[model samples]
Target chain A: GIQVEQSPPDLILQEGANSTLRCNFSDSVNNLQWFHQNPWGQLINLFYIPSGTKQNGRLSATTVATERYSLLYISSSQTTDSGVYFCAVNGFSGGYNKLIFGAGTRLAVHP
Target chain B: EPEVTQTPSHQVTQMGQEVILRCVPISNHLYFYWYRQILGQKVEFLVSFYNNEISEKSEIFDDQFSVERPDGSNFTLKIRSTKLEDSAMYFCASRTRRTSNEKLFFGSGTQLSVL
Candidate 1:
C-alpha cells in the first residue's frame, strides 16, 4: 500500500488569512484528490488533480506526480473553512481502483 | 447538484449482530466506493464496486465485510458480525468515470456504534 503523509497535523488561523497544506506520497499516483471534511463529517471534494494545477474559488491545489507530492492553498479563509483537509491518492498499482488518504490537516479559522 | 445519500445517519448494534449500511449514490455515476473513518482517524477505503461487482478492496475489507449493488440505485455494505472495532463513520462515494481526474462525490457518512 502507498503511504500518504500530510504536514502540519493541526493549524489555526485568523479569518482573512492565507494558508498552505501539503501532502507527500510514497509512490507514483495517477489519481489524487483533495477533500474537506466539515464538522458534520461531510467529505466534500475540493480538487481532482493528478498533475498540474487547479483552482476553485478560494481553494487551489497542485500535484507533482513525478515528485510524489501535492499542495493545497486557501486564501482569505472564513469560519466555514474550519475543518479537516484531506489528501487522497490512488497509486499506479491500483489504477484508480481505491484511494489512500492522508491523516489530514485540521484547520481552525477564527474571526 | 446531485449528491450521494446514505440512510440512518447513526446506527447502534451489539458486537455479535449483523449490520447493514445503505447508500444511494449519484444516479448518473458508475463507480461506487465505501470508506470508513475511526474516531480521529483518517478515512480509509474499504471497497470499490463497478458493474455490480467489487473492483478492488482493501485488507480491512475482510471476511466480515461485504458490499453489494442490490438494485440499480441502492448500494450497501454489510458487516456479518460486528465488533467493537467496527464502530466508525462509513461513507459512500460515487464517480462518473474511472479516470484519474474524475472527482468523487461523497455522502455525509453513517456513524456506526458497536457495543
Candidate 2:
C-alpha cells in the first residue's frame, strides 16, 4: 500500500493572506485529487491534478509526479476557507481506483 | 453539474442493529465508492462498485458489511450488525470512468451514530 503524508497538520492564517500545503506519497500514483472539507463536513472537490498544475479560482494545485508530491496554494484566503484540506491519490497497486487520503492539513483563516 | 446524492443525512442506531445507508450517484457515472471518515481521521476507502459488482474493498469492509446496487440508480451499504466503532461520516462518490483523468465527485455524506 502507498502512504500519503501531508505537512503542516495545522495551519492558521489571517484573511487575505496566502498559504501552501504539501502532500508526499511513497509511490507513483495514477490519479490525484484535492478536496476541502467544510465545517458542515462536505468534501468539496478542488482539483483533479494527477500531474502538472491546475487552478480553480483562488485555489490552485501542482503535482510533480516524478517527485511523488503535490502542493496546494490558497491565495488571498478568506474566512470561509477555514476547514480541512485533503490530498488523495489512487496508486497503481490499487487497481480499482481506490483513493488513499492524507490525514489533511487543518486550515483556519481569521478575519 | 451532476452530483452524488445521499439520503438520511444522519442516522442513529443501537449496537447490534441492522442499518442501511443509501446513495444515488450521478446517473452517467460508472464507478461508485463508499468511504468513511471517523472524527478527526482521514477519509478511508471501504469499497468500490462497477458493473453491478464490487471491484475492491479494504480490510475494514468485513463480513459485517455488504454493498448492493439494488436498482439501476441506487447503491446501498448495509451493516448487518453495527458497533460503536462504526459511528462516522460515510461518503458516497462516483466517477464517469476508470480513466485517470476522470474526476470523482462526492456526496455530502451521512453521519452515522451507533450507540
Candidate 3:
C-alpha cells in the first residue's frame, strides 16, 4: 500500500494568479494522475504523467519519479478552476492500476 | 469522443435493499473500475475488472458488493443489501489499455443515497 500526501491542503488565488500544488508518495509508483474535482463533484482527468512533464493550455504538471513527488502548476488561474485538485498513484506490483488518491488540495479562485 | 457514462445520476434506496449502479464505459476500453467517495472524503478503490474477471479489490468490497460485465458495453456494480454507510458517489472509470501511465476516463458518477 502506498500513501499519497498533498501539500498546502488548501489554496486561495485571485484571478490571473498562478499556483502550484504538490503530491508526495511513500512508495514506488508506475502511474500517477492529476484530477480536478469540480464544484459539481465530477472528477476530470488533467494529466496522466507517470514521469516527466506535460502541459495542457494553462495547466502543467511535472513528476520526478525518482523522488516520488509531483507538482501541478496552474497559470493565469480562473474562477472556473475553483475546486479540489487530487493526485492519484498506482504501484508497479500489487495495487497497480488500482488508484490510491491523496486527500486533495482545495483551491478557491476569487474573481 | 467516447467517455464513460453512468446511469441514474442519483439513486435512493432503503437499508437492506438491493441496488445496482450501471456504467457504460468507453466502447474501446478493456479495463473498468469502481471507486467510492464518501462526501468530503477520499476516493476509495472498490474493485477493478479486466478480462471479465476481477483483477483486484479492496477490503471494503465485501460479500455484499459484486461487479459484472453482463454485456460488451456495460459494467455494473451490485450491492446485495445497501446500508446507510454505503451512501456515496460511486464513479465508473475505464482505460483503453491496462498498462501504466494510461489515463482513466471517469463518468459523472452515480450518487447513491441510502436511507
Question: Which candidate ranks first by lDDT, i.e. highest?
Answer: 2
Candidate 1 lDDT score at position A38: 93
A88 Cα displacement, candidate 1 (Å): 0.5
Q: Is candidate 1 or candidate 2 better by lDDT?
A: 2
Model 2, A61-101: lDDT tens per residue? 99999999999999999999999999998887647777889
Q: Is the docking of candidate 2 incorrect, acceptable, medium or high quality?
A: medium
Determine the iRMS, in angstroms, of model 2.
1.3
Candidate 3 chain B weakest lDDT stretch, 10 residues? B96-105
> Candidate 1 lDDT, tens digit per residue, A1-111?
799999999999999999999999999988899999999888888888989999999999999898999999999999999999999988777545678899999999999
* Candidate 1: tens digits of C-alpha lDDT, residues B1-113: 68899998999999999999999999899999999999899998899999988888888999999999887999999999999999999999999998645667889899999
Error of 2 at B102 (Å): 2.1
Candidate 2 docking DockQ = 0.72
Q: Which residue pairs clash in candidate 3?
A: none
Interface RMSD of each: 1.9, 1.3, 1.7
Pairs of residues clashing in candidate 1: none
Q: Sort the predicted structures by lDDT, highest score first.
A: 2, 3, 1
Q: What is each model's TM-score for chain A?
A: 0.97, 0.98, 0.97
